[model samples]
Target: MAQYRWSYTSLQGKRYIVGLFHGPKTGHLMIYVNSKIVQIDFKVFEEKVYSFFLEEDLCEITIKKDNGSYGYDFQINKEVDTPLNRKRKAFNKVNRNRIITMFVGLGVFLAVIITFGISQKRKKEREKERYLQEMLAKKTVSATATIDSVKWSGDQASFYFKFYEGDIQRARIELIDKAAVDLYTQGLPVLKGDEFMMTYYTYNDSTSLKLNEPTNLQLANFMYRAFEQEQKSQSHLSEEELRCRVKCAFRVSGISGLADVYFQAETRESNPWHNRLTYNKLVRDIPFQEAFNEYCLPQ
Candidate 1:
């Protein structure tokens, strides 16, 4: 019998252990964190030397049997020194130097700098929290809308609907990505006359609304395609052009509000960085009427 062991710290700062034991005809492998086994696998012995791959950790392990009993040679291969690793190392070095400097003659200056940095960070965090709270505190309006039209182009779609809130009757448009459209239609074709209940929050100074329902699948297949398309074209286009391209697709059918809702939800969750700043700013202040005139209305 032979035994081998390897250990490494994960990117998330968690320690893990990988152990392998080889007998006459079979080999057993175990992976653990803090002495709690997380994975176990078995392989049939083929030769004196055996190699296998671990998918979870992206590592390869080779074990060789030695002449002496209870002896084995272990070799573990892992990708280290990546860009993230290098950045972490650099950050650690800088932090270490800063700590050392603070302990020396410049302690008062370092203390003042650290205090100012922390104060600024806390102020920004408080501002963000206040913004979210204000948004959530707004009044919610509920109404039912009948889909009057459905338009599709490329990976985007628009739904035109009419609704009545109290005595006020209005026609509204909602935009959705191809993934949301797929979900709304249940893989079937979308048509006019579909209906849904909409609950949205309205801003005080503007007629802009934030939707509160139909949380679309975050990792839909069409979303992946959209990401791929953005990645391919992002390098060639300016920030403004990319923003206009995304906004224009949903704007033509006057469903820009729906697009805003979708993007806002995605930003709150996990949105890609390509044109993110531009898209976020575009939808930040504009109401539905302004967006419709700028992008949807024919000049």
Candidate 2:
């Protein structure tokens, strides 16, 4: 069977199929045109040329030496080195390169996406492990603190507060970490002589320094507005009824981190939220909103 074949169309629209059968050991060379034998040469060795005519075009098949092996080339009318043929060869080469580049680009994009996904998964796993460790090492206890002193330094202020929780009575200074100065004005919105409740974060095994409370106090001013509205609406009520209205307003406002602010008989001394700067700021102007003047001062 012939291993090499090519098809061509002539200028006059005639079609021809060309095939070559060559035996390297026997040196038997044969050419077929349209399934019929056109040429045969026995004892043909390394190279040979066979030419034929179809219509007005002269076609040539050349078996040439290529490196250590031999190969064949076909051309029509001496058009192998023409400008149009050279341009066609170059265009085909560029198209092949473009196809290869497209596949390579697709592969790189998929690799980047997979790498990003793996990195995100590992980050989340690390975060979960860190959270578990923190939960194991942390201890939370509710405590009462009275603001004994206040000092302002740059954008931050330090508070010397007295904490009395269980059998522990200690004077604490807080919110002065180097990494966080903006958080100073948040949770402990207090002045001298003011008091409030806070959660203490510490370790059971150590008497060392620990966090007093969270510093991200998201103050809800709308609660005070609602309280004022409730006061106005219940102005005509009796004294006890008005007190109930105030209590209701306070309870409703405390839904957001300020829940323990209301005056309960047993817990009144420990819950001085009404005397803190958060409640007193309604009566003071800006820049002095955290002043010591508590308008809703508890007697």
Candidate 3:
């Protein structure tokens, strides 16, 4: 084995020791900082001289094999106080400052982008709330009307109302009222042919209207109670079979509007029970001349 050592001192007077070791089949350049091994890589050469630097060119070491011997020759080159060293020191300082400035600028740019995104998100939310308030402030029309039909599409419910306007004119009120949706979802009383008074406001210059008060019709409570009784009495049937039978009964009673509500209530989280309780079940469970009379009869 052959060994060669070179030493360097930085501008701050910190010392670094470097070593080159060669054996029959292996060679490595090693660096030591504060008596601890820092960096190393294997290098192999035959009959040729190799040169390596320590401390970023502060010192250099050259190794050469002897002409007729297995031993090697080592030479050290130390950094001297020359004009070239002065220029190199100045270049290193400028490069370090440039890197620090780049990192600071990048951090500031990322912060600005995150702040802009949050500001835009909040601005959109405020605009949405303002639009909802403006729609609610519109002029309202209150009337007593019989629910002729109820249709549902996506999250919106459209109630067809028959009221006298010189002659009978049909008006559609579409809304996403949470209470009304919850009542229908829970199998509470919501059906065609039900009568109730509603206060609503118009939008799009009277082109559309929506209910804003009394989230659910008052008569729904009576239907809900009758529905519970019928469900309990017919508990023996499977849920799907019960739903099909109830749909048939709604069609027979001329209140097929409830079928739309039933289909809308099906969700991934819960079983569809909106169509499982029908007017036919109420009439079967309670004797009534007509299915609508069962809703008004004493519970």
Best by lDDT: 2
TM-score comparison, 1 vs 3, better candidate: 3
Give the candidate order by descending TM-score: 3, 2, 1
Cα lDDT computed for each candidate against the true fold: 0.52, 0.57, 0.51
Give candidate 3's whole-model lDDT.
0.51
User: Regarding lDDT, does 1 or 2 come out ahead?
Assistant: 2
Give all candidate RMSDs, comma-separated: 30.2, 17.6, 13.7
Worst lDDT window (10 residues) for model 1?
205-214
lDDT leaderboard ranking: 2, 1, 3
Residues 151-184 of candidate 1 have per-residue lDDT tens digits of 8888977777776767877786667787765444
Worst 10 residues of 2 by lDDT: 257-266
Residue 255 local lDDT, model 2? 31
Please identify model 2 stretches exceeding 4 Å from their true place: 1-136, 139-158, 164-167, 175-237, 247-299
Regions more than 4 Å wrong, model 1: 1-112, 132-144, 183-193, 197-299
